[model samples]
Target: MTDHVDVLIVGAGLSGIGAAYRLQTMSKGKTYAILESRAAAGGTWDLFRYPGIRSDSDMYTLSFPFKPWTHANAIADGEDIRRYIHDTAHENKIDQHIRFGHRVTRASWSSDDAQWTVDASTDDGPVTITASFLYLCSGYYNYDQGYTPEFPGLEDFEGEVVHPQFWTDDVDYEGKEVVVIGSGATAVTLIPSMAGSTKHVTMLQRSPTYITALPQGDPIAGFLRKILPGGIAHRLTRIKNAAIAIGFYVFSQRFPQQASKFLIGRARKSLPADFDPKHLTPTYNPWDQRLCIVPNGDLFRTLRSGKASIVTDRIARFTKTGIDLESGEHLDADLVVTATGLQVVAFGQIAVEVDGRKIDSHETYVYKGMMFSGIPNFAWCVGYTNASWTLRADLTSQYVCRLINHMDARGYAFGMPDPAGASGDAAPLLNLQSGYVQRVAGILPQQGSSSPWTIRQNWFLDAWDNRRADLDEAMVWTRQREVARAG
Candidate 1:
C-alpha cells in the first residue's frame, strides 16, 4: 500500500501530536498524518506502568503550550499525563489523522523529486508512504526494550525480577520484601510507592543519585489558576517553572559546591537525624546525572517510618533469594525491581537512505539539535537533559512548521544544513554522563563546536533561536532537479 502527503510525522506521542498541531495551525492546508508504532497515543506514558509512575518535570512546562494543563498536581501521574496527551489529540482532531501500529522501518530521500519514501511494517503487511517533509518525533529511546545490564547468576535467582519499563499490573509485591536495584529516578519513585504495600522495600544501589523533594502541586500556580484565565495562568506557571528550573541548572553548573551542599542539606532535613547521610548524598555534583525528585519527601518519610531503606553498595551477583553485595552482605528480597536505566535509540532505530546511499548517524553532525547536517527535509525532536523535555519539543515543532512555510513561500523543495567542516572534533551530542547516554554516545551524531550546529541545553536560547533565527543562515535550500529544469 502507498500513501502520499505533504508531511509525514512519525510517532503519535507528545512531541508528534504537538508537531501535528503546529502544522495544522501555522502551516495551513498542509496534509500530514502521524504514524504511531504502538496502538495508543502516549509514548513513554503508555509504555511505563510502574507503581508511582509520574513526571520528573512539572506538567505546566511538560505539556503543550497551546493546551492548558488544568490538573491540580504539577507533578502528575503517568496515567494523567497519558490522558492529557490523548485529550490534546482528540481535542485537536489529530487522532483521526494518526495511523496506529505503523512501525516505520526505513526512510529514503530522493533529491530528484525532493521527497521521502518511508517504509513501515504493520499487522496487515508492509506499506509505503511518501512525503515532502519527514518529521521524527518518535523520541530517542527504544520502546520495545530497556537497558538491562548483564548480571552474573541472574537466572539462578528464584524470585521474580522486573524492570520498571515493563511493569505489569499482575506482578504482586504485597507484604513481601522487595529490593529495588537502582538509584535513579525510577528507583526513588518505586521505593516510596511500593513501600506502602510491601512489607519492606530496600533500595539497593551501586551509587547514590541526588534526590530532591518538591511539592506535588505548586501553590503559586494554584493561586494563579484561581485568579487568572486558564490560558494566562498556564503561561505564567510555565514561565515560572521554567525560570526556576533553568536558574537552578545554571547555578549547579556554576557553583557545584554550593548547589551540592544545598541539595544534600535538603535531603538530610527530610530524613531522620540518626539516618546516615551518605546514602542520600551523591559523589558527583548536582545536575551531573539528573536529580531525582520525590514529591513531598515521600521517599525520606518512608525511610524515616522504617517502611523503606537505602543501601549504597556494589552487587556481586544474584543469589537464590536476593542479590549478594560485594561487602559480604546479602539482601533478602521476594521480588526484585531493576529500575536501572533505559537504552537510548536514535530515530526509533529506523534506517535512513539518501538516494540509495545508507546514512550512518555517527558520520553526520546535528544541525541546531533538530535537523541533521546534509539530511534534507528531516528533523527529530530531542529535549533538554537538565530541564523539561517538552519545552524543547514545543520549540522544535514550531521551527519545523516555520521551515516548511519558508520553503513553500520561497519555492524551495529541499533544505538541509551544510556545515563548514566535518564534526570529527565536535563534542558529544548529549553532553550527559548518564549510563544510557554514555553507552550510545559513540553511535549518535556529534554537535558542532560553534553555533547553528551545537545543541544548546538552554530553553531560553532555544526558544529565541527557534522563533526568530533565519533558517537560511546555516541551511542550504535547493530546488528539485525537475522543477529547476522546467523553470
Candidate 2:
C-alpha cells in the first residue's frame, strides 16, 4: 500500500531523527513519516563497525537540545553513541514514526501537485510514497560504497582485505599484522582499538594529519550539570566549547605561527622528546581538512602499551606476502584495512527537479549552505568538520521548521530559492581538495563568498543566524508565493 504524509524524512540518522523530533514537537496538526533504509536507526552508529569507531567531537553539541548527553567523556564510543541515538528516538517517541528498511532510491518532484514522489526499495519490495516536504538527512558518507584503493597485485596478497565501512564480525585478526591504510579519523581510531587484539597495526599514510587530544570529561560541565537543570547545563557547555573554538580560529587568522605553535607545541610536549615531528606534525594549516580527536589520550595509551606503530610511506603494490612500500620495505599482514575515507554525496544521491527540468546538483550553488539555489520544499543536512555536526544540523532543522510554519500559516504549498536572476559573477561552491568536497565542487551549494552561508565552520555564528534569528525577513520565504497568487 502507498502512503501520504506532510513530511517524509529520508534516513533515520542523527540529521533525519533531529528533523523528526523538531517536527513532532513544533509542527501543529502535521502528519509526518520517517523512512530509514536499514532495519535499525542511528544511521552511521548502526552501520560503521570498524575498530575504534566513535565520535571525535564532544557529545554535548552532538545530542539534541531536548536530550541530555550524560557520557562522562566529552567524546563517546560507538556503542555509547548508538545507544544515545536509540535513547533519543525512544524518549522523544519518534521511534513509532520511523519505518525502517525503507531505502529511498529515487525522489522526483511534481510541481503541479506541489509534492515529492519518492520511490523506495524496502523488504516488502518496491513502494511509492508522496509527501508535501522532503527532508534529506542522509549524510555525505556513502552507505553502500566506502573508499577502497586499487593496489596493483592486490590479488596476490594472501591476506583478507577489508574496508572499514564494510567490516564483518566474522573476520579474525588475532596475532595478525594489520595494516590500516590512510590517516583519517577512521584510521586513527582503528589503530588504538586493534593494537591489543592484533599482533601490530601499521598506519600507512602518504602524508600526516593533525591529531589532537581532548579531555574525556569536562570539568566545569560536570559541576554545572550536578547543580543546574539539564537544559541549562547543555546551553552553558555548548557556549563554552564554541568560545574556545572561536579563540583558536581568530588566532589562526591573525597570527598563523602562534596558532600553529599553540597547537603543535602541545602535541610536541605531550609525546616523547625523540618522537619524529615529520610523522606527527602535518604540513597543512589546522582545520584544512578535519582534525582527528583522541579521547583522554587513549591512542597514546595504546602506543605506550607497545602494540601499535605508525608508518609514513606510500604503497607500491600488493604481493603474495604483503604490501610493498615505495621505500622497498614489505609489511607482512594477515589482513589489510583500507580505512581510506568516504565518498560524499549531496542530498543523498536523490534526484531533484524544478519545472520539469532535472536538477544537476553539480550545476547549482548552495544558498545559505542548506537549501540549493533553486530547490523548493527541501533542505539537506550534511555534517560538520570543525564543530560538532549536530550543532549546525540542529540549527538548519530549526530554521527549516520556522520557514515551513511560516509558509503553512499563509496557505502556501512551496518555497524555492530563486538565484536565477543573480549578479552573474559567482564562483563555485568549494575551491579546496577535500576528497569528497572536491568531487561535488561545482554542483554543491554555494554560500556567499565571505559570510553566513559561505560554509564557515563556526558554531556560535551558525547558532545565532539560524537558531536565534527572527523568523521574519529571511529572504527566502512564502510571502512571495502568496503575493504571486493575488496577481
lDDT of all predictions, in order shown? 0.90, 0.78
Candidates in order, TM-scores: namely 0.98, 0.93
Which candidate comes out best when scored by lDDT?
1
lDDT of 2: 0.78
TM-score of 2: 0.93
lDDT of 2 by residue, 139-256 (tens): 8667999767578999899889998889988878899999989888888888888888898888888888777788878988899999999889988887788677666666666786
Q: How close is candidate 1 to the true structure, as a TM-score?
A: 0.98
14-103 per-residue lDDT for model 1 (tens digits): 999999999999999999999999999999999999999999999999999999999989999999999999999999999999999999
- Total backbone clashes of model 2? 6
Q: Best candidate per TM-score, number?
A: 1
